[model samples]
Target: MKELLILVVVTIFTLATYYLVEPFAHSQMHKHVESEHFAYNDLPKLTATGDATRGAELVMGGAGCTGCHSIDVAGMPAPMDAVTAAASYGVNPPDLSNAGAVYDAKFLAELIKNPAHALLVEHKFDMDKGQMHPMVAFYGTGGDLDQEVADMVAYLQSIAVKPEELTPAIAYETVCGRCHANHYAKWTQIGTTPTFKYEKESLAFQIQVLEYQDSLVKYMGTLPPDLSIYIRSRGEHYIETFMENPQNYLKGTAMPRVGVNKHAAEQVIEYLKDSGDAKRHEREEVGKYVMIFMVIFAIFAILWKKQVWRDLH
Candidate 1:
């Protein structure tokens, strides 16, 4: 009876403590909720049917997407590379290589019309009167706005990359891809792709990641190191430490604290290790059996010679 009373008292105390501090704890999480106005569930829907061909035309001609952005589709030429674009616009525009696969059509449409509206916080418009915003409202004057937006959305969707769902590769791209383009390109050449084991996948989620990465690059003058062989080069512990706090590894480095949690870092690290050393686990497995067989053969040979030479001995 006393034990039962004690258990009940503990349960009541836990519940009371939770209820008392819940509001304050929730308030503390406010800043973590990137956008105050928009959320995944609350994102507006795109009603118009998108047309890829029309969207391509809009991008090339009326939309002027090539002015700052670039897509490597067959004949389309980008106006400038990342470095040049950054110089001209203050922010490097992302390639639309997998934009279709990484962004929601509705969100894309909204972003085209108003970049800051889709973000968690309202951008400071007073910083620079006319030139600060990288992307201005692009409702095409030559074409119907809805149809143009739909076509652009359709074009992006049509060119979506494989493994469309979020994966470790996508995480790397969003978090580490831009600055480490050479590493990413090398991985792609070697046919390495991101794997999604624990995290959920979505284009909208990827767009948020791309946006975050871009913001970091703009703030920091230098691009971060390529992480393609980071596991092999720096080892997992170093990767984890550097990722957790870059300054710990290199003093006065431009690399910002990415705030990647343990689980996310593990996922990125696993992807890097797997991509860089794909045959490591396989080789280890085969080596064990080979060693076992060699030992067995040595023992058998010794026994056979001993038996055959017993009379001579």
Candidate 2:
């Protein structure tokens, strides 16, 4: 009887060990990103370095990263290029740090590759729609993508994350990726997405009302409305209504309906009001002038390249 009791204890101990260590081990393998409260693991694996330097380059050099995001923005236009800072769709530049820290490499890879479906299966964020970036060029073609996907995974994996300021994949999936992964992934393959984004660098509205910022018609053609001071200038009613049915309000808008409930949308509103959009708007005028120069330079470069090729031939 004593021996039997001893065996039972050992079995229980082993089971406990399996349950606890399995998640950590699984996390190390690249399928899981660890967060403070929960862990999300659904995609393949991620890389160690997220290529933040490359990401920075993409931000510069006509890559137009600063087109639609605000990080420490102040003044009229934020620094960077692409166009004036705008926030047409009531969107904000969701921080990308420590995204992998929420789950694992695999989870992040899937989020980066196919954000729409990936967010749904993972039950991370509760977004009504999905994302529309250029992560995967050929997601819906019904074919295998081993290496190209791996590289994209690596690029996403290379991002450096802040362990302390980590958000759960569940929350991100619910609130973020659900709206754009599919759209952006689709756009990536066909290269049909907009040229510049609508973030900090773009032209932002000095007023924070939830109404469209189309005051200027000349540059407004390809720009989004600003949301920097929405809660302060406009009020909660506009913010909430816009969040609920953005499309009904925007009329043929590229923004998705994330289905932010009253409560959730309120929380987001609070977060936005508390958090500043940075001084990104300060760089706008500089970037716009620079972009014009870049375009001229690009045209000259193309012409020069043609001449060089002809001479060599």
- Which is the leading candidate under lDDT? 1
Assess each prediction's global lDDT (C-alpha) against the native: 0.61, 0.41
- For each candidate in turn, the TM-score is 0.49, 0.28
How many angstroms is residue 59 displaced in model 2 relative to the true structure, after the best TM-score fit? 8.8
| Candidate 1: regions farther than 4 A off | 1-39, 126-131, 164-167, 174-176, 179-313
lDDT of 2: 0.41
Give lDDT for model 1.
Answer: 0.61
* Worst lDDT 10-window in candidate 1: 30-39
Q: Model 2: residues >4 Å from true position, as ranges?
A: 1-86, 95-104, 121-159, 162-313
Per-residue C-alpha lDDT of model 1 across residues 187-224, encoded as one tens digit per residue: 42112335655455545444444554465466455545
